[model samples]
Target: MYYDIIVLGVVVSILFSELTRLSPAGLVVPGYFVLSLHSPMRAAYTLLIAFLALGAEKLLGRVMILYGRRSFAALILLSFLIDGAIQASGIWAGNPGMIGCLVAGILARELERQGIVRSLGALGVVTGVLSLLLLAMGHPVFGTQGVWR
Candidate 1:
């Protein structure tokens, strides 16, 4: 199931991005997110962590010049730091590992480019479509016995 979801998610994300010319939160992000579907709160927590990284980048951007690779590195570093901080705070114990290795950073990048509303809207739409496709594939995570099995 995990294998299927990740591969399919990448494929879906690429297709969506090509069609819309948007990142869809990066190619692998939707896959990571879809895996969290069984636990909605975990998904929300992941989003919170991503938003935190994005916010941190905004703050950091004000102090120094952050663009291109610098901006990307800062976002990834921040995501890891914030994820660690959250875990250390004992809030959730496990931090869901950043949705994907670069999910938060890439997502932050997109949000900055397109604004939160448009970026998230694109992400939500892509993920929702991916979820529906997974459902049709008979993935147990979606409570389906396997319509296409």
Candidate 2:
């Protein structure tokens, strides 16, 4: 069921980007978002981390040359560090999983390329559509129950 959701998300994201000429918060982000929908806090935490990473990137950009691969690497590293700090501080109660950092990095990159409002708007739209589809398909969108059994 998780795999199914991810595959579906990728397909939908690709189609959406083709139709709208914009990415839905990067290629794999929607899948992670949909998977974490059962735990809204986790999703929110991921977004927060992404925003933090974006802020860090913006701040660092003033002093350092961040472009192309350099920016990507910096964002990923910053997300990893932030996730590590959150975990170490026992801030979040549960293990939101590693997808958070990856998703944050992607989302931050998207946010940097496309304005925050647009990227987040697209992400929200994609996530909402995926959630509706999951619900319609009898999948649990807000609990531990899996689509299969």
Candidate 3:
């Protein structure tokens, strides 16, 4: 059931990309975001990490040659570093606070490729559609805490 979300999201993401030619904050991001929806705080934290990664990359780009795979790698590394720092801070000890940890990196990649506004807009639309589809399929997207039903 958990994997179903990813599979569905991938399918929807592919279709969305083909139709709009937008990355939707990376191909696999919506599902991971959807999974993190049970806790808005976790989702917000992940997004904050992604935004930080984007800013960090922008600053680093001035100092280094970052493009293609190099940029992707740098953003990912930054995301991991930020996530680790959040974990070590113990501010969110009750929860890992980095749900969809790698998602921030992936999202940051798209945010770097597309302008943040466009990328975020597409992500929101795709995620909303996916959530609705999940609810229609009896996934119980709301009022279940972390459970499917």
Candidate 4:
């Protein structure tokens, strides 16, 4: 069979996007945010993210993986560069979304290693949903708000 480079490019894009979740920007704050939330909004956001992340990843799996696998050699390298960008952005101002991207990246890598292509997408949705929920609940999993307070 012939190789398709375009497909690989798309997957690399998605992978780079997901890997961004690893940075503090993604997990902790979102988790805290969900915890801080007060009511229905929490559930609504969590569900929204879960659906978007999982649905998008699942739907776009073939396109992303085919492209990602073909260019596997450059995947992690790109992720590292992206991570630096996230940190730099944080230094300049403040970006919680950056953490989410970092976590997504880390989760994507794990999913890939496990041979669970869909896991990346699923993780995206799940984390997205969870982040929203935590934020609505006022948890501040990683927010400036003190959890103990």
Candidate 5:
């Protein structure tokens, strides 16, 4: 079931991106997010970290050149550092782990390319649609109290 959802997510993301000329965060980001619908806080925390990383990148952009592979690598590294700091500080109970950080980094990079509002809007739409489908399928989307379950 999880595998099917992931496959559908990838397909939907690709179709949406091609049709709209916008990325829903990243190709696989929506899938990752749908998995975390049970714990929305986890998604929120990940977004917070991604925003922090974006701010750092903007600040760093002024001091040095950031583009292409360099910018991508820096974002990933910054995400990891931020995730670690958040975990060490116990700022948020949920740790999104490396994959979460990577997704956040990817999303942040897209946010930089496309604008925050648009990027986030697309993400929200895709996530919401996928979440609804998962819910309709009676999956454990927001917990075990789902209608079908």
Candidate 6:
């Protein structure tokens, strides 16, 4: 019963964030929620997400540094892109938000390693503002109203 409630809560949070047009961070929050509801599954899921994000960050960082490109922006964008891909896969499997926390965590790790601590803090603020703006832009708050729906 507890696990069921936990799972439902995670699902609801994910769906709510989606419906309310919250920022991607909100969507990512459910990953932790879901992971907290289990042990083995959580560990496995986290491992996969971490690997994906870390691998991408390393590769992209090297590329950006080598080519003298926008490293910070690229890292942030790649983090989100990789997260979105993971979420998409989860949704296809009927477990949307299963890796939400993992995505956020992975991004956080990458950001810290790249010495973007200030920007990461800024991202939290930006995410909140964006969520509010999205809400004002006629986005719902807890239903099937977003593009994903």
Query: Of the candidates shown, which would achieve the greatest lDDT relative to the real structure?
Result: 3
Identify the candidate with maximal TM-score.
3
**Candidate models: Cα lDDT each:** 0.79, 0.85, 0.86, 0.39, 0.79, 0.45
Each model's TM-score?
Answer: 0.85, 0.88, 0.91, 0.27, 0.86, 0.34
lDDT of 2 by residue, 1-149 (tens): 77889899988889889999888998789888888766777788888888999898889999999999999999999999888888999877885645544788989999999989989998888888888888899888777763424
| lDDT score of residue 41 within candidate 3 | 78
Error of 4 at 94 (Å): 13
How many clashes does each candidate structure show, in the order listed? 1, 0, 0, 42, 0, 4
The positional error of residue 96 in candidate 2, measured at the CA in angstroms, is 4.8
> Per-residue CA lDDT of candidate 3, range 1-149, in tens?
88989999999999999999988998789988888777787788888999999999999999999999999999999999988877788766665466565889999999889989989999999999999998888776655565334
* Candidate 2 vs candidate 4, TM-score winner: 2
Ranking by lDDT: 3, 2, 5, 1, 6, 4
Question: lDDT by residue for model 5 over 90-132, one digit each (tens)?
Answer: 8666564544548888888888888898888888888788888
Candidate 6, 22: how far from true, in Å? 33
Model 3, residue 92: distance off in Å is 5.6
Superposed on all Cα atoms, model 2 deviates from the true structure by an RMSD in Å of: 2.2
Clashing residue pairs for model 2:
none
- In Å, residue 58's CA in model 6 sits off its true spot by 1.2
Better of 1 and 5 by lDDT: 5
Residue 66 of model 3, lDDT score: 98
- lDDT per residue (tens digit) for residues 1-149 in model 6: 33433344445545544564443233344333332433435434543554455567677666556222354345445556765786676643533332443354534454444334433443344434444444565544233342123
> Candidate 5 — worst ten consecutive residues by lDDT sum?
140-149
Off by over 4 Å in 1: 91-97, 143-149
